[model samples]
Target: MNSDHYTYRVTWSAEDAEHVGLCAEFPSLSWLAATPAEALAGIRSVVADCVRDMSAHGEPVPVPLADRRYSGEFKVRIPPEQHRRLAIEASEQGVSLNRLVSAKLASGA
Candidate 1:
């Protein structure tokens, strides 16, 4: 797996008082540095090393999020009352429940 293809994020850690780099595919791995660039570089190097180690050990390496396929469909369970409320809201808005829920999710609500 190419570490470059993996999803990476760098953000400030208030508790650590430094920038923190994170890889979505390797949730347990992180690198803290004084700067975002250093943090990102550190995390990338760590991921590359991990990938190499896993490969050498005959372990399955994770597919990069950028290279993975998503179906765009998933099931979510909510309480019956909440479901009924959403259904009514959808009906009042003249849209399907899926559409209403999709809008809400897209809005980050």
Candidate 2:
């Protein structure tokens, strides 16, 4: 196993009220919060700690998170012009808008 790289699973649930709900866990880390956003923030903090500890052991920081996966619904507001532009680009690339955006984000990493 690559001790420097870990796979953490984050799960989200709807709350009856306004708060978002989320939790993250791996053999190396665990955290939770009332919202998905909060849970992400909390898990980041925990990962930072894990990284620091690993660094102290004469190890490199965890490998870049290129393979980390995120799946969720999010809303983005773009003007009609920008929306049409992205649609055209997606069509040209033979991919859905979501795939286009995801590919762009991944390439930018």
Candidate 3:
């Protein structure tokens, strides 16, 4: 199976004294190793095994979040005060609130 469809993250774990690899789709599954590469490899191997087993049992594998389609738009809820502040800032900058917020978000601020 192509393991590229899965999401893997490797992070250091002080408790285990090793890097830990986790798949967001399969929260219960994890792998640990002295190095990030080893941890990732271990997790990939385990994921492959899991996929094969699930396939054999006629269980469905989850679609990875990365593989899902998304619309460019989404909604956010902000407090009335915060919304007022942002509206004032956007006005001061001579831009629509959406334009200001979009610019800020794009800049990762």
Candidate 4:
């Protein structure tokens, strides 16, 4: 398997006093090192080993999330009171509820 097909991220960990590498596809594994490069290399090595083991056992490996397509739409459920409040606020702002909610969500508010 090509390691480049996976997403690898290295982030600083204050609690560990080092950089930690994590693979989004393999949530169970992580690696730590003094530098981001070392941490990423360590995780990639681990992923290589895991791929080999899975291949030998005929286990399915997850497809990379980066390769997937996403629709811009999703559904969310809210309490009745919260829904009413949002509807009122949207009306007051002269916008559709969907537009108001989408704007708020996009702004991280």
Give the best candidate by TM-score: 1
TM-score of each: 0.95, 0.37, 0.80, 0.82
lDDT of 4 by residue, 1-109 (tens): 6767899999999999999999999999999999999999999999989988988899997777887679978999999999999999999999999999999999999
Residues 23-95, model 3: lDDT tens digits: 9888899999999999999999998899889888999987787888998779999999999999999999999
Residue 60 error, candidate 1, Å: 0.7
Which pairs in model 1 have colliding backbones? none
- The TM-score between candidate 3 and the true structure equals 0.80
What candidate 1 gets wrong by more than 4 Å, as runs, is: none
Off by over 4 Å in 2: 1-9, 13-27, 67-109
RMSD (CA, Å), candidate 2 to true, equals 12.0
Worst 10 residues of 3 by lDDT: 1-10
Taking every candidate in turn, the Cα RMSD to the unseen true structure, in Å, is 0.9, 12.0, 2.1, 1.9
lDDT of each: 0.98, 0.63, 0.92, 0.93
Model 4 gets an lDDT of: 0.93
Cα shift from native, residue 24, model 4 (Å): 1.8
RMSD versus native structure for model 4 = 1.9
Tens-digit lDDT string for candidate 2 (25-107): 23446566666677666766677676678778987664545445657667888899988998999999899999998788789
Error of 4 at 35 (Å): 0.6
